[model samples]
Target: MITISVTGMTCGCCVNKVRDKVGALPGVTGVDVDLADGKVTIAGITPERTALADAVAAAGFHLAD
Candidate 1:
């Protein structure tokens, strides 16, 4: 499992968007979004950090540092 802190996720819809986008990645098998904490946990094979960050950005959110 890889954990990423995401910003601008303020509601259920945001969570859903993140989940749907990240969860669709080739190696991703699971995704958990915490709107209250602005965290997204993903389970999958090792994924490129740049790809992950880009995906989050494309979905209209910032991948927190």
Candidate 2:
């Protein structure tokens, strides 16, 4: 599992969008969005960091450090 700190996820819709986008990526088996903490956990075959970041960005959110 990989935990990413995401910003700009303020509601259920945002969470859902993030989940959907990230979950659609290849090798992504599971995704959990924590709106309260602005975090997302992805469990899968281990995607490249850049790919993960791009997916998050494409979903209209920021993957924080």
Estimate the TM-score of every prediction.
0.93, 0.93
What is the C-alpha lDDT profile of model 2 across 1-65, one tens digit per residue? 98989999989999998999899889999999999999899998777878888988988998897
Per-residue lDDT over 1-65 for candidate 1, one digit per residue giving the tens place of the 0 to 100 score: 98889999878888888998888888999999988888889997747888888888878999888
> Least lDDT summed over 10 consecutive residues: which range in candidate 2?
44-53
Cα distance off (Å), candidate 2, residue 35? 0.3
lDDT of 2 at 14: 95
Instruction: After superposing candidate 2 on the true structure, give the runs of residues whose Cα lies further than 4 Å from its correct spot.
Output: none
Superposed model 1: Cα runs more than 4 Å off: none
Model 1's TM-score against the true structure: 0.93
Q: Top lDDT: which candidate number?
A: 2
